[model samples]
Target chain A: MARFKLTIEYDGRPYVGWQRQDNGPTVQAVLEDAFAEFAHGEEITVFGSGRTDAGVHAKGQVAHVDLARPMTSDALQAALNHFLKVRETGISILKIEEVDAEFNARFSAKGRHYLYRIINRRGPLSFDRGLAWHVIRPLDAEAMNEAGQRLIGTHDFTTFRHVECQAKSPVKTLDYLRIERHGEEIHMLAGARSFLHHQIRSMIGTLELVGCGKWTADDVTAALEARDRAALGLNAPPDGLYFLRVDY
Target chain B: MARFKLTIEYDGRPYVGWQRQDNGPTVQAVLEDAFAEFAHGEEITVFGSGRTDAGVHAKGQVAHVDLARPMTSDALQAALNHFLKVRETGISILKIEEVDAEFNARFSAKGRHYLYRIINRRGPLSFDRGLAWHVIRPLDAEAMNEAGQRLIGTHDFTTFRHVECQAKSPVKTLDYLRIERHGEEIHMLAGARSFLHHQIRSMIGTLELVGCGKWTADDVTAALEARDRAALGLNAPPDGLYFLRVDY
Candidate 1:
């Protein structure tokens, strides 16, 4: 058996998140099926670094899959992409390379990077309608950044964690959270060793209140200290979130 | 009558073109209908700076319209946008301002700026399928820029002009033609007072040959000097082209 690591990109609009579920198509099921086609109907299981909710895009999502048949990494990548294109799937295999069997896409992950886009304009979105979060009121990105800074460092993120999160503990080290304005859009970049379910989106939704002068930075700190899910302000939608990449 | 100038943005994938047609829906027709709804059935003509072909997007397309009834620019913009949203059109009114009665969207424009996007990668497109042109082979941006420079200044552009172009003269000055690589994508910015129909796409398609080392700068010069439509190398698809903005 040969194990290969694959870097994938997807629009995430047509799937039921990254995981395979019977409800609808998913990124994982799509990749596995594409691999099975070239593997001559050999059942293939592909493991991902993490799961992203439905409507969340990915510029670079890493995964690992083991194949019973041997083939050049380049050939396999090309073949998989060919099947994906033919199937009209939104997923694309960016790169593929051989990896040690010991490498686990889920367990060996070091860091995760995510980007959330917000279109801060009064006008409704046209070109970026489904690709970004649209906020009608004017936003103070500087205020949002200041509030985001309060969430840095190791802490109990229970306030931002989803109630249905499967993680046992809410304590996680947040490496960085930086927010900046790019013309009409607000981009927030967050990095961490790991995140609880809906943690990033929860934080962003609370910070948006600060951006619009509704909540102060002290409010964000208070919410974190509460360590209660009910203390959270709001949960940002999945449309604007993107799993940028995983760092090992 | 009050004249209003509109800065518009649109995802042109659904429209027939900028101009109104009997064949199908168009950007012009959508705007006209929206205005008519709010104008109490008064006939309103929205004149665009230039007509963009089908499947060509616009980030900053400019237009002008005359209203028989007096209304604040802001209110008019808001009403039109509300109607557009209700109709689910992929067009947005970025900005609206009252202009001089003499202002003309087409004749008064001093220059037009356009952008062409080329995704230079081996993978098939996903998120940017219709938003960009996918090129499998490697491209040399420097060579494309070098060849583009030769097209600048006043010259007879018959070679690049479309056979169906209705321009009275084939002579037009190209203000600038710049090629730059942005990550995995190649962006080409072209500026001119006016362009013959299909001139920009024709130039980009030919420059692509130079970018892939299939043609030299001298070859581009020869094509331009030939001043014949038969000498043109290629006419790029309308998918990657964007009507960026118009200067008054």
Candidate 2:
């Protein structure tokens, strides 16, 4: 058996999420099925770096899988893409490469990158309706960025963690956070070795309050100190979140 | 009556085209109906700068309409947007400006800018399926740009004009034509005071041949000199074309 690393891109709108589920289709299930077909009926398991919520997109999600069949990386990639296209799945195997047997997609030392997009305009969205969050009110990107700086280090992010999150610890170190305005859109980028569930969305939602003048940087610091979920502001919707890349 | 010049944006996938027709829904029909509702059942007509074929998107389409009822530009814009939103049309009135009574969306335009996108990759599209043209073959953008220079000046572009085009003459001057590669996508920008029906698409399709090394710059000149529709290489689909902007 050979282990291979797969770089994937997918429109997550159609899936239940990244993980396999009995309720509806998921990116994992689709990929497993495609890999099984490529392996000629052999059962296959695919491991992803992380689980993304429904309605979230991924430009470079990473995964690892083992196959009994021997094939070139290029051939495997092509075969997998062909199967995915035939099934009309929104998932695409962008690249595939042989990897060390010990490589684990979830546990390998790495960092995660995420991007959130907000269209700051009064007009309703046309082409980017589902692709971005449309904020009818004007946003102060600079203020948002200044407020976001409060969330930059190791802390017990209990206020940002979802109640249903299974992680044992509420503390996680946020390595990077930046906000910038590009034309009519405001983009927020965040990076961390790991993140508590809903942390990024929670922080973004709170920062939006600062952007629209509903809150201040001092308020953000106060909320972080509160360490209670109720202290968190609104949680940003998943529509604007994208799993940009996973760094190894 | 007060005349207003409107800047609009739309995702043209669901509409028949820009023009109103009894055969199916159209952007023009949608706008007219929304305006009528905003005008309290008053009959209204919305004139567009140009007619875009089915599945052509627009970022900055211009139009002019006369209304007997006087209202602030903001009020008019907000009213129209509310009606359009209620109807769930993928159209947005980006801006509204009170204009002179003589201003015409079509006739007063001094220039029109168009953008065409092509995704050169082997993978089948997911998010961009209907948003761009997907070409599997590798493209040489420099070659295409070099060949496009042949179509920049005034010429009798009979070979590039659509067979059913209603233009009085085939002679037209193209002010600008450029091809550039942006990462995995190739963007083609074209400008002219006016264009024959399908002229941009026709030229793009022919240039694609040059991009793939199937045709040369000399071949483009030869095709243009042929002055026959049959001499055209190919006609690109409208999916990747966007009526970018109009200058009056």
DockQ: which candidate is best? 1
Candidate 2: tens digits of C-alpha lDDT, residues A1-248:
99999989898778779999899999999999898887788889999999998888888899999888778998988999988983378788878999999999899948999999999987788887767888988999999999999999999999999999999999999999999999889999999998888888899999999999999999998899999999998899887889988888
Stretches of candidate 2 exceeding 4 Å from the true structure: A37-41, A86-88, B86-88
Go through the candidates in order and give each one's C-alpha lDDT: 0.92, 0.91
Clashes of 1: 0
TM-score, per-candidate, Cα-based: 0.96, 0.92
Q: Return the lDDT, model 2, position A61.
A: 91
Weakest 10 consecutive residues of candidate 1 chain B by summed lDDT = B82-91
Q: Candidate 1: which stretches are off by over 4 Å?
A: none
Span of 10 residues, lowest total lDDT, candidate 2 chain A: A86-95
Question: Candidate 2 residues B9-114, lDDT tens each?
Answer: 9988888899998888999999999998988899899989999998889999999999999899999999999999823788999999999988999999999999
Q: What interface-residue Cα RMSD does candidate 2 give after superposition?
A: 3.0
Position A36, candidate 2: lDDT? 81
Candidate 2 lDDT:
0.91
Best by lDDT: 1
Among all windows of 10 consecutive residues in model 1 chain A, the one with the lowest summed lDDT is: A82-91
